[model samples]
Target: MSSSEPRPESGPTVPSVLTWGTWAAVVLVAAQLVLGILMLSGSWSLIEAHAGLGYAGTLAAVLAAVSAVVWKRRGGSAGVMAHAVAMPVLMIIQIGLGSAGVKWVHVVLGVLILIGLIGLPMSLRSARRQSL
Candidate 1:
């Protein structure tokens, strides 16, 4: 390569979801845990707990959507594409449970969302590596 020759076009520096989205995912997990605790302690009503958990789940879904958008924007990897699809699916399940006010569904979705929060960072790291 010569100094006069131009380099290939580098992709966007930031992921589509960015730091805020990741933080939102994190917050969602923590908030869901707290909401669950509140429900158990009777400090909060079931409806309130459901609402809080739903909010967190929605945040995670948004993060996934943003990740997918970012991937599309940068022409990134398949992993991001997966995140885009999976996140919304999980969010829908999460919200349905919240709205239906089902006990087991709420618990299961809460667990799944927490797993998603933990898995997302690892997934992003893998995506970054693959993109590189």
Candidate 2:
């Protein structure tokens, strides 16, 4: 605690690279949810063209989840781990609903996924702060 010793930093620390990457994935997943809802409601037939978009979002989420796992292993954040798990499961549920011809399920899941996506970053911040 002496001045000659290393001082504790003040203010909030910047998020880690993995944290930022995870946030980006969450944003993309939110976008995917919106697009999926539009597609299911027949408001957007461009779904076919954007099929790869969902896949890309899924891949990003998977990568984010993997990053979260690594971060958690390094004693990072529980929020990150939860985000990693929730997002992929939600993505799978969305896919299953779409395939089952259950448009309403897709719609509901889309909204829920969007909520979860937005929550991910907040949760990460909260977790990091609490851990610190």
Which lDDT tens digits does candidate 1 get at residues 1-132?
Answer: 664433355333336454457657667667767777777687666656657656765766676676667666666555556665676677777677767768777777777777776676676677655444
Tell me the alpha-carbon RMSD of every candidate.
Answer: 4.0, 4.2
Q: Clashes in each model (backbone N, CA, C under 3 Å)?
A: 1, 0
Model 1 scores a TM of 0.71
For each candidate in the order shown, give its overall lDDT on alpha carbons: 0.64, 0.67
Estimated TM-score per prediction?
Answer: 0.71, 0.72
- Candidate 2 lDDT over 7-105, as tens digits, reads 354323324755666677666766666676566677677675445555666676677677777767766666568776778778777777866878787
**Where in model 1 is the C-alpha error above 4 Å?**
1-16, 46-50
